[model samples]
Target: MKQLYDQRISCPHCGHHIFVSLDASEGDQDYYEDCAACCNPIHLNMHIDYAINKLELRVDADDEQVF
Candidate 1:
């Protein structure tokens, strides 16, 4: 039950907004994505709240949380 969706997120390194893939069915995950503007790896921490049908994401650069 892997549902993939494109989610817009800001790059921590360059502050550029980019769309990244998100898999809600994975429940929760931690991964990295390269920023389109800066080419820097951004750490993504995802949490799914099934009860509320919502997804919470934390984008980070160098282990520092951005949002």
Candidate 2:
């Protein structure tokens, strides 16, 4: 797996497309980034699955409630 990766994702707040840099060297990560278009917080959860050799990224709005 690559140590560094770039992913294009849409902002949950404004639906703006943006590029995010992911660092796989750190294993799994949970972080927040401000959307460029709306300036709203975007929650990012990154998980590296060693068994499948895949990187999973989940993006959502910071204010979203989980049911």
Candidate 3:
């Protein structure tokens, strides 16, 4: 299916705003990226529900996985 991915989310640790580009056409996925502000590792989860047209993203650090 087609997808639209455009959203800016701030890092929870350093509060640095980063543009997240998630491919909604793909399946549910998880990945890791570094925060440009703090240079810390971040676990990124992209949840796209095609049935409801919903997109959810959760980003966190190694120490802080929920916040």
Residue-level lDDT tens digits of model 3 in 1-67: 4586877888878999988777877778899888888987778898877788788888877584565
Q: Write the number of the candidate with greater TM-score, choosing between 1 and 2.
A: 2
lDDT of 1 by residue, 1-67 (tens): 3478888989988899999889787679999889877899999999988788778899989764578
Model 1 has an lDDT value of 0.86
Better of 2 and 3 by lDDT: 2
Residues 2-60, candidate 2, lDDT per residue (tens digit)?
A: 99999999999889999999999999999999888899999999999999999999998
* Candidates' C-alpha lDDT: 0.86, 0.94, 0.81
lDDT of model number 2: 0.94
lDDT: which candidate is best? 2
In order of appearance, the predictions have TM-scores of 0.78, 0.92, 0.78
TM-score of 1: 0.78
lDDT of 1 at 63: 63
lDDT of 2 at 35: 88
Best by TM-score: 2
